[model samples]
Target: MTHFIRVLEFSNKEDALKNFCGSFRSGESDFGIFSVDASTFGSLPSSVFAYWMNPSVGDAFSRFRNFAERGLKAQVGCSTKDDFRFLRLWWELREPSDKWIDLAKGGRYSPFYSDIHLQINWKDNAAELEAAILKKYPYLGDSANWVLHRESDYLKPGITWTRRTKSDFSPRFLPAGCVFSEKGLSAFIDGGSRKDISAALAILSSKPCRSLIEVQLAAADKSQAGGVANSYEVGIIKSTPAPDTDAEVTERLAELACRAWKQKLTLDGIQESSHAFHLPAALRDRLGSFDPPAIEAELARIQAEIDAIAFDLYGFSEEDRAPAQASHAAARTDDEETDADDEGEDEENAALIDQTAGLLSWAVGVAFGHFDWRLATGERAAPPEPAPFDPLPAKSPGMLPDGAAPFHANAGILVDDQGHPHDLARLIEEVLARVEAPVPEDVRRWLQKDFFPFHLQRYSKSRRKAPIYWPLSTTSGSYTLWVYYPSLTSQTLYTAINDFVEPKLKEVGADVTALRNKAAARTRDDEKQFEALQAFELELIELRDTLLKLAPTYKPNHDDGVQISAAPLWPLFRHKPWQKVLKDTWAKLEKGDYDWAHLAMNYWPERVREKCKTDKSLAIAHGLEHLYVEPEAAPKKTRGRKKGE
Candidate 1:
């Protein structure tokens, strides 16, 4: 009884003669009929995974794809070989590190990082862009580029791609797959029964097939030491054996896989909703309620059920099932733990964050004249439509620094010379003051503490790097402040100084003087109140002086054209390069001694000088001028009390 199995490498032509002789010899022998070839089916090459190997320009090819806003599209929507992972399958578009130009669009070039590069809307610019890209990357003009270049027509309903090669040969399913892929990512697209293909996709995406792929395919490149470098060539992939296509079992597998894919899409949908600053009240309530966790738990259960079905289909034994079951269990644990961490006040906080974010959005709109005073009365028909590069209106009711009372004016006030509202600061203050508790107990405090954190969480999924309200601050975070999108304009700063800062200074000065008089009349019993007022007075004085000094330097220079911060234009649009800004701004803004100029100009030069001046002034005021220059002695060590003492 000669028992020999042939594991033929389907794509390797050199193995054909060897396979033929082995098969003939086996048939000639007594046990010839017992010989079986495990990999006689389709291989990976039978699938469609094309790479656009273009000329690598020195850094110039790196331009259009970047971590910043200068990318060809909103960002480089490509997937690299390293991006795909089991179950958590998705592509992360990246910015080009090397510089590239978009000649047609007056942009730079970028080497292919993903297979899916063309946009559905890029049809108008396709020929021009294609010509320019091919000129710079002539090699990309190969016939193979046809599929990708003509992707709009080919991008169908059920296309998918697999990682060409991976450390683990476990299949990664991309239901919402891209049009093209990098060299190591292979895609699958052909006409067939939708149900059959979906079932096959699920079976491939599941774990049982992973064990089969490893046993039949050739080892990939020996590049990484001590790591399994497995390859999934088209020939070998197609050669993977399976039950009959029309079998009842195959239908069941297809149904399970489709269900799992749908569940994954649900999670993606949830994440997409949270990406924007606002969440619908219904979604917010559901997320805060019992729905989200329940859905997550149910999804995990479904995946486990699929794993069991796959085991039976693959004829995996108890021992083989051990690893697969363990993998499924581990994944379930991770999902549950994630759910547990997100429970409790998470939903409430998310809802509150959304509400606060809406308020901030409204304020920005008002500041930019996109919104009118009707927002205050809750009579605004719809949120203001945002435009990135357009000039702001001279004065919407909420945006005016001063204005006349129009007919039916709810908050009666006279109009300015420009026929706008007077006292922009007053409107802002009133709007903020009227905000009820918990939505934001204190708007300023909320902005200073929580807004950035929430924004980070919201945009984390998209990996957006820019922020609408850029923060400028010192390295130490001891001084941080905000710059609204419009405020980045050279003109807005000038307007703000006269309309916003000057009036604020007057208000602070008035409060300081009132506090000073009260302190003068205070008795020993009122020391705490007197000290509190004095501290506040000092802060106000510093703010007043800072604004006064910045007045001359903050002149309008519309040509500087709002700096880099205004490029994103609106908060709703995607932004990047915001993380660093947010980090520095939050750090500085949290400190009591931080500068406000950092907000006006994205620089902080006066931080050290101001701190020195503050220390010197404080020392002189406290009659400790000498001590101020000297390092203080270490505090005396305090002894712990004995049990009785």
Candidate 2:
């Protein structure tokens, strides 16, 4: 005895189960079975009589009851014994479609108010059962309708039987060994409409149809059990045949070859290769004698046009230029010519003047020393008391003896009208008469040395020689008089002398009067100018003191090479150019030119005096050494031609 299982189709689980139970109650089955597998009633085995039900039918009943309880006004059946059996059959019946299976898997579907199940029995007459099913339900009788049968029935040989209903049932009509095996005890209830089931069975049994049909059953039992009567129709479909495997592979390989050719064509520089290998016949016919070099020349021409446009936008033009190139060429030419002339003249003149001034300075220094000695000791030595002399008077007509010439006098000095000397005190009285400042001793000495000695020398030189003859006057008998003839005519000499002397006298007298007026005015302007200079001197002293204080801390050797005294003071006053700066700053003072006076005063410390020794410009400007000092001898350098040849 082999144990087996089989699938059965039913209109619904409840209808199928009910039909099975009805057959058993009618004494139409001989299989000994006492229990059924179901969910509505408890599980049972042989000898324990019980009804089975599907769990889905029970769940549907509960849902119906719950909806009713929630005031939905839906119909819910009573749970009596009959109702319980009915639910069990419905649960056992096959569902019209497997769509219920989708519902069981938690997918959405049309609400299934019923459930179905398949029935299994140990042994039964399958042919008899089919006949009995048609007799009980006449819709199963059509040849076009499907009938459930065990596969083993057709496999048996030498057995033939005609189908019949339970009403015509006879023992002679029964097929021998028709009992359902456990493997063949399956049945199908109609799950489609009567008409659709008939058509479906017709199609299934046709020679061209590949599908197999089972059975069709009504859901009328479900309607009585408070379930929907309609059944879900379904078909198990098989797909059409596929192409041969080798043909598919060949097609794919062909496609792959075409794709590879396309990929090769997409590579850079492949066009030239493509043109060489795959030229069309028409293109080859038309391209005779065509030169690619000519095409390249045309492309080069187009590129040149673009380059020209770019150059025009950015490059320089002839108009946009500087004069530097032309000017530099001209300058070079001029420099050559100038340099040729300058070489001879410049060096000689520069050297000759420098040497002559140096010799004169040396002579003047010796003269100053001798004069200083004579002043210190009042002696007549071989030097013959070389006294310091004033500058020459321009009014003087003749030269003095070599020993007595004034220190600054030369033919050049005598020619200048402004260089005439007056009385020293009178000159001062004239110039500063309007000023209340006391005459400084150094200034008086400077004036006397610059002027008085020249005047005396001129007078002495003029009176030296006279006429030896005497002229007798009518009033006296033979009176002898020495006569002096002046260098100029009497009228000229008188006029020149008066002109030289009168203005100076007038200047002195007028200055005294102006002084009285100025004193009367008593403006604080003079005092302020004095005070300003004093303050400026104080500031300079403070600055110098500050530099000295900083000097010890600053090591010029180790630090930046700057000496404090070398720092210029002119910029501190914030004036114009240095010349105007000096003029404006010292103009308010009573001194004729305070700037020069101030410069002279500070002109020489030891270092500066030493520097003045080499600094010709400073020596000339400030009367350093030679300019201020008297010469020991007149310059012996001859100005006149030597003698008659």
Candidate 3:
């Protein structure tokens, strides 16, 4: 009987070509069919498990060193165990902080280059963070959840990848001076080795590594939920075969990878959220061509070179490379479908939209005094262009110093109503006029309707969604008041009510009354006008009442963060998804799920104060350490004389 099974999926049962320990035929699919025998497993290094698939594939493994056996070993990054208390977007902090260090959390599909926007509370090498985590987890070293590990490798240059991903196994070259998160796994080369970092990155991020990792994920991953996603965990990576880094091929791959990384960062020069961000690529004042297509073309060329050289280093001939190449081709198609980095932009006129929206958002930031307006008109020198591996900047290049912003929204309030002095549309226009850029014809409508959703998408990372510019609007969104998050206080909502909503309601009321009391029998147009005015009047009244109802007790604390602070006003958020997120967060806050939040102390002082006695972290978080009472040591009892020993 001829017996042949698929090496990956095991579908072929007819053709038995080879029967040795390491024998297989490339199937029509991207995997191979192999004749399996029980004796073949004895020749492999890994457990008689799924990672090797079948013996023919395992033979490939036996010939090479896996990551576990190589100089570089996959290392799991730290888990905050409580992200909200320990992690924050870099821009959220107002100034350069020694307390917050660069954190490499998994971002989008970009490879070779890195995108690290998060900063962790690694103050004093995370002394307080570990203490806080230990207070909660208690079984820190013994259990699954750990806050800190491998402290010696914290800031060393290594490679990183998303532990959980819907896309294929993609990795990036992480430079020195950053701590990686659990979801963002790291694999560092042993510092004593002669292995080059850039060369290793090129090899590991190539098509061969991606396909091999995909095979492992297909067999072992269930944490990716039911989707086409997978968890690229430590065990799987440590068991994968490592390609031989031939010295000549290694040098070429290193050069190309570094070039690719640099070009990729250059495209991000306009990206406000990236470490490489300096000036908008669309800015006319910049001296170079910032063509997206050109940048993309160069990156593709560089990647092609990297992949070809990587295949050579792996000792693959044309036929041997075929399946991996096919697999990678399919992975690219899948990545395009799930690319959230570009906001699902698939040849969807993305660049034009990005330029328009990013410029407008930056303008809004300038109005809030978050960014320096002087740079838009060349009044101040623009910061020098950033390189691929510059130390993370203290602040984004053109940001105004912390307190130097003069035209920040008055009382932390800006209204959307036309003719209002603090109208957001006017503020945007003033900003653009300085740069001599033409304002969009529908700019006001865009701010009211499109801007918040886009801003929410832009600022969100690692499951933390907090848009700094919040729009507390009426039911129909005809009127919105933008509240600058940094300047927000408990009284800011009161300002929105007394200064903006109340005056608008008064005008709406007068218009409604004037229309109803018209002497002439109302024309059709007048009737329509009367109806709108009446609806507006009622809506304005309802919006005002809701704010007044909450004002007496709605004390906001910024340490609770923009999301939690705005959560109390969830009903006022016109964006339904944002409203729902805030709504759920509010529920969590009320239910003690967010007890670490300072707002919890503000709302439920007794409960938090009581917990302060038990959970020292919560005590420290609330600045209520004085309330903490350490549990008394158990009575020594003198060991009861051990029954006369």
lDDT of 1: 0.35
The candidate that achieves the highest TM-score relative to the unseen native structure? 3
TM-score of each: 0.43, 0.12, 0.78
Q: What number of clashing residue pairs does each candidate have, in the order they appear?
A: 62, 21, 1
Q: Candidate 1 residues 476-514, lDDT tens each?
A: 232233444433443543454455435544765676576
Native-to-model Cα distance after best TM-score fit, residue 501 in candidate 3, in Å: 4.5
Please state the error at residue 235 of candidate 3 in Å. 4.9
Question: For model 3, how does the per-residue alpha-carbon lDDT over 1-645 read when each residue is reduced to its tens digit?
Answer: 233444322234333323322353333422233334656555444444343243334455667788767777677788787787788777666456677888887755668775687788776577557767777776553343345774537787778887766666778877678888877888877862323667777777887666566666553332222335567888888877787776676678778878888787776666766565555545634535677788789998887888787666556667667767766665555554443322222222235557788888888888887677776566767667654445667776666756565555477788888998888899899888877777888889889878998888877766677678989888998778888887877788789889999888888888888888894888999999998888888888889999998787788765566678888899999898999999999999899988877677778999988988887677777777787787765665664555667
TM-score of 2: 0.12
Could you give me the TM-score of model 1 versus the true structure? 0.43
Local error of candidate 1 at 452, Å?
1.7
> Which candidate has the top score in lDDT?
3
Of models 1 and 2, which has the larger lDDT?
1
lDDT digits (tens) for residues 3-67 of candidate 2: 11111334476766666666667866532223434443222112121221222222222222221
